[model samples]
Target: MTAGNVVLGLCSYTHDSAAALLVDNVLVGFAEEERLTGDKHTAAFPERAVNWLLDTAGVDPHSVGLVAYNFDGRRYLDALAATEMYAGRDTTRDRAQPRAESFRKVHDRFGSRMADLRDRFRRARVVPVLHHRAHGLYSFASSSYDAAAVLVVDSLGEVQTTTLGSGRRLAGGGCRTTIVEDIADPASLGYAYGAVTEHLGWRRGDEEGTVMALAALGDPTRFRALLREAIPITDGGFSLDPRWFPLRVLAHDYPRVSAGFIAATCPARDPSAQVEAVHADLAAALQERTEQVMVHLARRVRSVTGLRLLCLGGGVAANCVAVGKIVEAGIFDEVHVPPAAGDSGTAIGAALAASLDNTRHLATGVTGRCYLGPAYPRLVLAENPRPGLTAHRPAAPAKHVAMKLAEGHTVGVFSGNLEAGPRALGNRSILASPLLPDVVERLNDTVKFREPFRPFAPVVLASAMADYFTLPQPAPYMSIASGVTDLTRERIPAIVHVNGTARVQTVTADANPFLTEVLTEFAALTGHPVLINTSLNVKGKPICGTPDMALDCLTESGLDALMLEGWWVSKC
Candidate 1:
């Protein structure tokens, strides 16, 4: 495709802002704004990201064919107007700033693009793809299944709580996916999940992962009565009882319930140091119930469509724990989850959807690397190494860094094309001995500064994965949670989560030989085939971009050493 025909999908201003550039239906670059902005879940226009892509790819903005925004401001504006009418606000004065504010934000973002465009380009071509279509396309276009049942779940999108689609491969190699069912209004699983997340002491979107993790600690059997009362599953789907959970105007920050259930279900924890067994049990039950419901939904999709393969997208797919259960249920023969599985991935989906009609085509397998962002050459760091940091040439060679890692000192491996997704894989990751039991606690306390219960993933030499975990297939994106045997866990306690499962990313020598050789060599030295692989970043920021960034993270975090390209540095 000529540069002009390329469609750049931008999801800006909304949460998890991102940009995905598509050329002739092939995704070339996709990145989230948070990574560039250095803010966790940063919701802003990804100007730096856009500029970086144009610079890296050497493409001009004017050459872009179409810019696809993932949302329709008109729809949001309609919602805002209706909200004001519902609230009986003074339309002239009180609501003026809000609407003006919205216009200003949108104008400030898109207006620049409008001016930058060639004078000949039509304004109508700058399109706004529907919200659900973006979610559907993200799952369908990135999936390997040609004709599979598709489920897109998020808190809310274009009045759609959940959608069911069928994706099929087209004759000539592309694919066509159609929405078979759209559950709008009340029957939204995403909203039901969000309601509970809000009920817990966490922000709905930001804290859903916490709730998912916390659920394992508690049993929700006692709360089943209350849960059913709160979110009832009907023949259609799930619904939030308007009394307990009310849908407020779009302007409201968090979805509001009548403050009644908050007092009833949520009580202050005792000041004394005591863990609430009941609370833990309640959380456990909720998680179980959620898993059951998701299975039920998956089964419904299978029975309704009779398609065994499934592709999942949206925020709920981020719940790897629930996803593991869904996979283990054996309802679907195979499942694929997109790397960015959230709003950030929508740009890829929407642009792809716009390019195809309803025809069956299997998507290429998930992109394993998260090196989609801009990369800095080693020379950039060599020109100016920060004071006291000696820039030695790559130790031994690119291939020999793996041998050094096998020899036992912790080695930070940053090489090759960086990964294109959220996972660090081997290209942009920190590699250390997983044999150390304290590795997990150390990484969390000294580097991650997050909950110790949070587990690190293991990137094993792919040839050795079958012996460690009963993996159904190669999990390139770290999407599947697999069980590590007691024998394996004893050897590598660092990567195992509390649930006794690890989000494993297996590597093949053919895929990443330099890193794989390192793992193979490490195994020869220690008899363990896995390495402790985490993103090369500080606790709050996205993964590092330059050698300097990686070096700073390594030095500040008190990590032992770094192996960049060929140069190896040990902490002085």
Candidate 2:
């Protein structure tokens, strides 16, 4: 491989399809196909994303010295062959065509899809890195520690769903990686969690967050009798009791009718006031139990590696509540979590792992900004303002608008650079007073059109996070959860989730100057450094892409004001 060579990392042909480009070991641009394609959890080839990355970086694919894909086709093929053999040729015959075709298509594309580029440059190499190792790389390499214990948890990364390892910066600026443990087949926390998510009538990969949200509203204790018997932890990992589930259902079928039908037999009540006490207890128990399992795993890693720092990645990292528990336990002095902990980040991981010639790795500070997505120039906004809306350039300036917010005005902010992750950094967010209970309802009904149970997060001045949350570290990416003090929770009830935990994105003056300025103005006026921040989008849509998208939201929703690049518009 070439030193400081450009590499293309693509996680297409599977879930969370995305494209990332690494220029000289630095992540220049990364984006999921779903956002641009407008399909949630898009699993198709990331053609647009790949093209965008090359175009944005002003580099030809031919310039890429290496192309890193997230999985080993040969290993995956072996796993499939084993599954088919075990199922018997007669039974496998019914299921093999589509499965075989999927693998074939990916293989064919990987070999020849970028032929023109290879011809142009001809020096680039295609490298197939194992999926879990890439995941471990993404977490450990991006971490704050020079040496740390790394743990990756996911539904399944190829044949392995979970891996435990140790990673250290080499003495002379290289990286040392070791995999101490691996669990394959039937031993997956993700599968366990996914099973329950399916049992609850959610859309599996897409709706797991919803289950996590809903769990906060119910009693976990009420479901322990049922769940404990269903999912059990063992030396290998976690397992499911056949009484509560059926393994014969294809792994690809998520929350299917068959699964639900099986669940109905082992009854649970629909969410209701009469069942609130039981439901809340059950939710709490499942959350508690999941945390318990994670803690056990963390303890095992610490025991084996004796590392004081820990790094986490994968779909399970999305569980902030569980993450908070791990942090509070004090097992690790420090923990680092990637903002894009899910499959979308695999592209970055794959590229970095494949490009490791000397093994010296450094965590690239969170990409310069989330504004990696397409932008709308002034023309996009001028030509269209949405129906029933008027546009204005502020005469008094954004500082003046900040003054109004400080004085308790609710504002919807949309300006320069849309964020890439699930969290809405300041660019595409609805800013509001955390003190109002009615604000949550209003935002939900008018702007979000989302489940009322969904809660907003607070973007607070980084320096002040400790004053309100039991945070051990500054959470720049809102990657983990922190407890809200009773006093603060009472004051900013709108931002607290049902479980009294908040996924906060701490704003530093250096990282987000404009947002910090607005919050500073608000803090000066109201004596609080936090504002309610929720994604700027309507239900079932991705975050707003343009100023017009922002304006459309403001006029269509019941919001009172819209804040944009140094300007705020209000209805006279």
Candidate 3:
């Protein structure tokens, strides 16, 4: 089939459904379905996201020659069968409805539904890419490095859980990836982390970050031995002991695995119970073991591939603490993780596969930033002003917002395009002074309604990054965690985690002039250029994508004001 200039990528029928549109290898639009639907981590079809991408890019459906879906159900079922055989599981089942039959039924239904959606693009040829391969491609292709060792560790992608590969740009044009290793399903670092999250009375995939936060507060000395027995590092990869964890069964059933593991190892607590020492210790052990295993895998990848640069993808790459440890270990000269490293990012990967030949224009080899979602028009404030709120267009919106932030007031700053990934990088963020320690507690209680243990991130001026955090380079995506200097920690106590490290976003004037202006004004006011920057959304909700959603967040939360583009809207 002849391919067109525009390629549409869709990731759906799984968590964090998203869509991406690449026009002649340039990513013009991308968005997660949850942001538009107001559904958190929704697995539904990303029709709205696809529509928005097409509409925003002004690309006709017929121009989309390739429609790439991130999952291949047939391959997934085949992998499942292989996993069962590899694990020596029973293959016999009820004649009427076997386990494989159930999977096949769902696969057929989903494929049919997807085909129906493909009717919109009459000339497009739809294709499905392997899950982990998509992740690897996105990581390596979006990176600035010409060659790198790619590692993808996730709960499960088809039958594979982890993939180690190498990617390099071809001499002529485009890029190629070669898979060097694969860790099959049931023995996954992502599943292990999710299990630990569930045992700690948190949602599996959604609350792994909470577990990572709690781990810093506990001593893992006592629990490490037990966790090590469950997840042991092997020669090339790691293995989950079936006795300690029924990996095959646990992979499919979330509740049963968490319940069984807790019943056997620790006492199950109430859903709302405060995190106790035991919970913290368990989280600490899981985190420590996971980090060790990841380092082992990364070192192996580096040795095998002889590559200095490392690019990581999959859900496990979202673990900033683990990624930090890997970076600090010096296993790789440089480590790069995309802004959206999880499942949602696979959409970008699938699109890139079809658009690789045309990406020669991206000479820098690096994908720019996370600000690829829809942006609200500045004139919208004047067109549709909400009641009980007054909007004023200041001569310098950044300075006005910075002044509010200097006054210890939490302000929602919604400007430009929304961020594509989980972390908010100033565009759609809530800003506050990081010097006030009480601000963390207030933001948690009133604004975020999240666990206090989860620390806020800091946006620092790029020039001043070395003065604050011990980082090798600028982390524009907030993908790496670095330790704050003692003096810097003293200056900004609220942004420091219990471990004295922070997920820092370094902002440059050229890349983010608006945020840089705000930081400049803030530095004039407080003698520091750092401010607390968190996503502008409440707990269990996706980040605000539109002006109305931003206003709603400001109205519902305890924020003092909201900066929409050049206009400032304050509470009545």
Candidate 2 RMSD computed on C-alpha atoms after optimal superposition onto the true structure: 4.3
TM-score to native of every candidate shown? 0.84, 0.86, 0.93
Model 1 misplacement above 4 A: 1-4, 73-124, 185-187, 192-204, 252-258, 267-282, 357-371, 377-380, 395-411
By lDDT, the best candidate is: 3
- How many residue pairs clash in each candidate at the backbone level? 34, 15, 0
lDDT of 2 at 335: 77
Per-residue accuracy of model 1 over 1-572 as CA lDDT, tens digit each: 36545667777666777777755455677777766656767777777777776666667776677777776544443334344442454323333445445544554554554444324234325666777788877776666566888887777675566777777776778666777776664355666666666655556666566566666666677677776676666564566665556553345553455566666566533323244565555556666666766666677677767898888887777777777777888888988887777788886666665554321332233344344656555543452355555556753454455565555455676776556556677877877777765777778787766554567888888888987876677776787778887767666666777677888887887777777777777777778788888888866567665566677777778566677765666655
Candidate 2: where are CA atoms >4 Å away? 1-4, 78-124, 248-282, 358-380, 395-398, 404-410, 546-552, 567-572
lDDT of 2 by residue, 44-86 (tens): 8787778888887788766778877787655544345554553
Write down the lDDT of every candidate, Cα atoms only: 0.66, 0.70, 0.82
Error of 3 at 455 (Å): 0.7
Q: What lDDT does model 2 reach?
A: 0.70
**Deviation in Å, model 1, residue 353 alpha carbon:** 2.2
Locate the minimum summed-lDDT window of 10 residues in model 2. 248-257
What TM-score does structure 3 among the candidates reach? 0.93
